[model samples]
Target: MSSFSSLFTRRKNKNRGRTSEKEIYDQEGIPKHYDRKLDRNLCSIQELFKQTTDYEEIHIKVGDLKGCVCYLGTTLNKSELNMQVLEPLREAFKQPETDAHRDLDYLREAFFPAVSYEYAETLHQLVWQMLNGYAVVMIDEHSKALALNIGGTDKRSISEPSTQTIIRGPKEGFIEDINTNIGLIRKKIKSPRLVFEDFRVGSDSNTKLSIGYMKGIVNEDILSEVKLRINKINASGILDTGNVEEFITDETFTFFPLIYNSERPDSISGNILEGKIAILLDGSPFVLIVPSVFTDFFQSTEDYYQPFFMTSFIRIIRYVSFMITLTFPSLYVAITTYHHELMPTPLLINIQSQREGVPFPAVIEILMMELTFEVLREAGVRMPRAVGQTLSIVGALVIGQAAVEAGLVSNVLVVIVAFSAIASFVSPIYNFSIAARLIRFILIIMAASLGLYGILLSLIVMVIHLVSLRTFGIPYLTPVAPFKLKDQSDVFVRVPIWGDRYRPSYLMTKAPVKNKDSSRPSSPDQNTGGKKEND
Candidate 1:
């Protein structure tokens, strides 16, 4: 019995590092005698891992001379590893086979053959890998650890964008996936000159941002400036591109959007062809187009899809709608209150009759009705869809009818408010509609304070603000401010496709001349049917 005990103790000592038997027995060996006391605490890999409940599939294998323990959470790509290493080893142990050739390399080749891996020794890399959804493999007596890619799928499918809808253009919209978004853009613009530059922002989040442009066509200085501004963003989190845009925008307080946001890949591709830089965020459907001039707001994707004559007429109407939305009510108020001499006698008489028996002054009545309409608009948006429609119809009918009977607001003021609301809705972009609403209130206040003089003052201030504003260093009111006649063909009225031979000068495009004069089609009458005087 003493010989058998001695042999077992020798084997145990051989398995561990050399240490004095006295120290081993006293400090490390199992306790021989105790007074009904609990076993002394011992350090182990299992105890270390048991502290965390996150890793449920961690596997530990004990062998004769060496051992291995890996968190099952790490080796995800190695389905074969789970099968070959775990299953085979379990079966081997179940049977009584002592095949002593289970080394680290042997196990690796058997399970994960030809698989590439990187060693991560530092805690920083290990934690980063784990957070990025990698599996970590540890081997006994080796400080280096293996990291395997095993990220889970959690991406949303691409769908049409809620905003920036087009009637005649492509129905596809940018998705949350960065790679898919890039592919969409690439699919539209097949040119090799199209360049996509990637940038990593958000110090903690490391969100990926991509800047796309045509290589030679895009202005180098402008691209440099854009890249510089993007790199300057020092936020902790960037959930969407708006975060980066807000951080880098020249005027944060201004109501106007300096950068144009669009979801249509074709629009972005068109902007790129025009030498503009497009910024795409990882998780946002909207891509930001820089150097957006005032004319861009008036332009729509349908303009290119339809006949130029029809597009030009629509463009003119949009411009007219913009003016009507902004100043129609204020102008009405100003003329009625202070500039009645400008109005014809018949119209003046009609307005006077409409305001008769109204207890409130014209300005007061306008203010009251405008405020009520704005409140209703907000309520319609905040309430549920079914309730929202009911509220909008009921609210408009009840308030409008009640106001007429109560004499708090004139029927004329109500008409003006309703017309202005409808006009504001004509704006193609929702964000621009918001700006229109705000500016309408400003114009109303100006008209009330100083009549026509106040209206003129507001117009001058607005024009100056617009003139001073720059979208990515390009003047907001371009071609108009710079007085470029060539680009004017597509400005107020979109010219026929044949007549649109030049690109906008503000973009500084390399090929401003779209096609040569020789490419112009000659009429058959002029070519062959002319000069029959000899007969």
Candidate 2:
């Protein structure tokens, strides 16, 4: 409860400065400022929400003042509305007050000391607050309205992150609620240097979003670029970070994701401290990290929580899996079609025998199998959880066996396609894996047309495309293509935590050195190095 209070108290401060629609200007429709008359202000607010079925206006009194509280019916917590707002007003009404003592200031200081609130100076601000579950108090002849945050405590409980799960790490994942998400981050990184700037996006949805970064560590150029892109968003609505990603991303023509997103708070916080910007949307559990690189997608937050050598090995395996998933089917097709001499005599004979009864060519066989695998994958995702896994497994087995037996596809082709599909799942970040998945079809086509030569050309083109890509002016292939010897510590191989003493050089962080204590951990016995216990 105390945590929630502090969260909101800080949130209120963050939201106070931001009333803009993308920081350009507030949404047009309502009056710019509040009118002196109470009924006039109430009427303006009411008309804006007249179409809203949940909008409610309640009449109330405080001392000699009469006013109304306007809010959405289902948004507020009833208990808090009574105790923090209504009860205070009623208690204050019991005491006598002179004209100067009965103003908004009087009500704020004496009654609502502990409450999270702010002054809504304009009718636009008032309506915006009401929509966000704030109960606004408008006194007779007072132009200023007091907006109290009586928003409900209802939100999905934090559970293990389903998308990016790990055996060892914090089990708590980010929830849909933005406050809860920020609180989770705040808990992990308790530093005043971690700053969050708020923005109200979507002219219709008015969805809130915040970009959080370590103030001193973050690059000024990168931070400016992030804010610029976010402010330039002209969308009608932004339901999730996915929508925001499309708008702010540098390039959309490529299959690769320009930004990284995660459901874990630790991942976002860790990135923030590392001089990367974390963009969190109001209703999304996944937070987007700016300036994502090719290597960043291969990384898992759990990697840091485990042994460094094991993580490095796992990352190497992921890279191998990426190559296998991307080219295994193509390689099989190329070998069988034109590069048959590359295979040993026995293996070639076996493949030739397998292909003897098959009607379709190797290319057709693999494409058909790949398409079927994709259809089954989609079904598994869209179906009920209880049956989804069963259906996918059963469907794949039945289809593969039937195809091989009926000579629709060779047995080798089935093995190749299935192995490729399994390898595709090895990537830590799902969206990053999709690049290889999408490019695989093109590679298969190349392999079919010109065999091994076409496959090599296709791979060269893919590399050039990746090297050319940029996210927020940062190279997509950081530390590898540009070749920074220092930043390579955490790329394909994660050195011990103490060895990785600097942020990624590509980010151009304000403070490059991350480790205040750069010394590697040593045994107590090693510190005493052949000396007596007293020494």
Candidate 3:
């Protein structure tokens, strides 16, 4: 204990001088210019990457030029290094008096045939590139090094989206690689108007992220707002899009998610077509779409793929389910505790019979059941997939049966809780589903205190809160509270594709009409030309 305490004390003293001159030099970040001497550059890099066990340095000679290459073994592909850098340089040096090997520029232009390479004169540039999986080539007399992009291709293969499953839409999903994710979007749009702006967040982590939007279609002001919010993120490590979302969201205290995110590439492509901007993070599969409204969460990519009638029915069901998920437990508590007369006599008698021997009040019973279900859901998510599903099913059955048989919770409450759970699952977006789940508890508390009137009060408060919310300055309840009739075509009920001509009015898209030439096809009518081949 004494040794540990002393060690901690020493660490605190070391950090106490964190603002001192030497510490500032270390943390003030990499130098803008590289040292003219190769040995100096090598020494500084070696010290900087002292803790990196995979740091590798190799010595090589090129036509009387002495130099070294530094890179992280774990990050750079050795095969690429041998083929693109080592082999070419070795062959060039073998030519006794080759002028091409004398200069770094000639070496890169004539000798090394790498697809992409950049000159880095500054230590800051070299360090950043090296950290991002580039190999730094340091020539003896040259003031700069060739930063070859030899980043390893060690990422997960593209697979079907685990979440946001669909029946008739594209099977592809976004992976953790930002470039791959961008490529997926590109494959869908293929338009020259699509623009992706790159930004690096996290001062220490330096996580790369990109913002994609249609140049001519997206609102310029909204794009500017998105950039401003992203630039304002000053955190040291942005682990995922969730961190970025929180930093850039309009409201921090609200239960609802202001920015919508998805793992589906088609969903992102659809959002971009609608003039929304997508933010892709380097290490997260979920890409965030900005200026999301409440209606956006209820709709899915499948809605556009299927027939209008079928999609519209499913969309309406989603909205209905959302309401039930958010208010069912509260409604049950309110009706039983205070609004008993509002229920049908037969239903009331049935509920009373189930609750006959239950000792807890309606509020307690509802809370208990809700908590149990929430625990089961969370367990199913956290546990191993093989065991999770089976465990949750068996656990729910056992716990529910035991609770009901022991008269701890009524059978009617179990039915209500199950319905609420199922309804919550109906939301297309997981983040939105979480928001609904959390809001359900608040409504339950309100109902317990003030009954149906409490539920009404909570509803009014929630609606007002949602109305006040904004995503990148666009109202959350867009086309609903603001009431734009044209945008209503795909809000609650999806109209035919041809009729959804204009983009959402709130977006103020530069190009309003999605497809001006789009029109429904008509069958040929029976006429003289169609009369009969015999005539």
Candidate 4:
């Protein structure tokens, strides 16, 4: 048998190409030369604008000279650019000492006033500036092009995250702007140790992604691996962080998510503190956290907001809910259809009596009900919010009552299906719940084939797949399969606040403890002394 390394090396060598072909097609297929060439002689800014079709507005203004044109890529605050860029150039052209080449620096200084604006020396830098929403000013004889930083647009304000909503935690969520998202994380952490590394992934889109992590906290090897994977992602377009995540993820075929995604800044910050890397895309609200574990899906921001005991109880409930959601319906069918002796005598008799008039077998009954439920769910999601609620309530009542009356399914089966649906909803992550729903279908089929033995076989296969999976080299079943006691405080059971002094062990942090001062208040009167006295 060939080793994994040898096989991988052989594949790499087979796919290897010369410089020109490699530039066009990296390990991942992406054409490098998407942008049109910038002609040195061309003074028509409209020519440059014609190359990029993605931008909605590309305005060109001829100023300073017959050849000099100010090229604006986006529609953001065009009035300001007209005033700041074109106005100064017009004034300079009117002057007697307006030597187009000699007075260019002075004109820029007088116009921008802001110190950050700089001139692009190369064609690559010029193109990048245009892609980043900066207006480029080019002259006939000038060797350099001026890039302005006056990007101001009317965008949606930071709002509460629709997906990762929490009741007791911070209501603020990340917006589409990458800079704003980074700012939100910085506001929450307020630590200089946090590092934000920027990378441009897509060849055509040139979409900006910022990888955030704590300097000494994150495992260097894992961090490097994540960086390498991201750097190697050579796609033509990356509309969201989800695209980057899917491209860089270790497993593409698995149903379970390797990278944990969240829109809440607090959650991303928490992961960063735990030595996990977060990828924030420019146009996406959700940030992708690397080195995600299975247990991470079961956790929510509310877990930390509530008391440790309450959180622990809730965590236990979620774990139980997950199991019930996945196996309960299958187990019901397996025992009722094959292993009748496993059921109590009274229960078996009751089930048999109830199912007497049913037209379908146990497996068929389950499949029918599950399929109906899934259709209703999809309809509810796709419909308008107000109408969707009405549809769900009316549909559930109508379907349940009609099915029982028609004698297609037993009352016990109805109850079991309903319980399974409710159990699936108990999952904190909606994506995780969807995954559970898919896996439950497989489990049901397995149960139908070989009863309980098939269910056990499915479980073993699932466990093997999970154990083989890794998110940026961190095991998917981290702190559980590897059995890290320190991290177990927050997994399976939430330990007390004081007991969980360190961060998750899977991260391999240099300083695991987030708080040096773990002491509780000595007295309630310490900070509230004045209020107490006044009362």
Q: Give one digit per residue, the lDDT tens place, for model 3 in 334-362.
A: 99999999999999999999899989899
Please give each candidate's TM-score.
Answer: 0.75, 0.93, 0.92, 0.85
Steric clashes per prediction: 1, 1, 0, 0
Which stretch of 10 consecutive residues in model 2 shows the poorest summed lDDT?
A: 4-13
TM-score, model 2 to reference:
0.93
* Residue 105 lDDT, candidate 1, scale 0-100: 53
Model 1 stretches with alpha carbons more than 4 Å out:
1-126, 129-152, 498-501, 510-535
Q: Is candidate 2 or candidate 3 better by lDDT?
A: 2
Candidate 2, residues 1-535, lDDT tens digits: the string is 2321231111222222333532333444667768888888877777777788988877887656788877787888878888888888887777777775457887788888988898888776777677788988888878689999876657899998988867898999998999999999999999999999998778677799999999888878677767767776777789999999998888899998999999999889888888999999999999999978888889989999999989999999999999999999999989999988999999999989989998888899899999999999999989999999999999999999998889899988889999999999999899888888889999999999999999999999989999988777767898899899988899988999988889988777778999978888655676678565897
CA shift at 322, candidate 1, in angstroms? 0.8
Alpha-carbon lDDT, every model: 0.70, 0.85, 0.85, 0.76
* Cα shift from native, residue 83, model 2 (Å): 2.1
Q: Which order, best to worst by lDDT?
A: 2, 3, 4, 1
Candidate 3 residue-wise lDDT at 528: 56
| lDDT of residue 492 for candidate 3 | 92
Local accuracy of candidate 4 as per-residue lDDT tens digits, 161-202: 988767898999999999899999999889898899877767
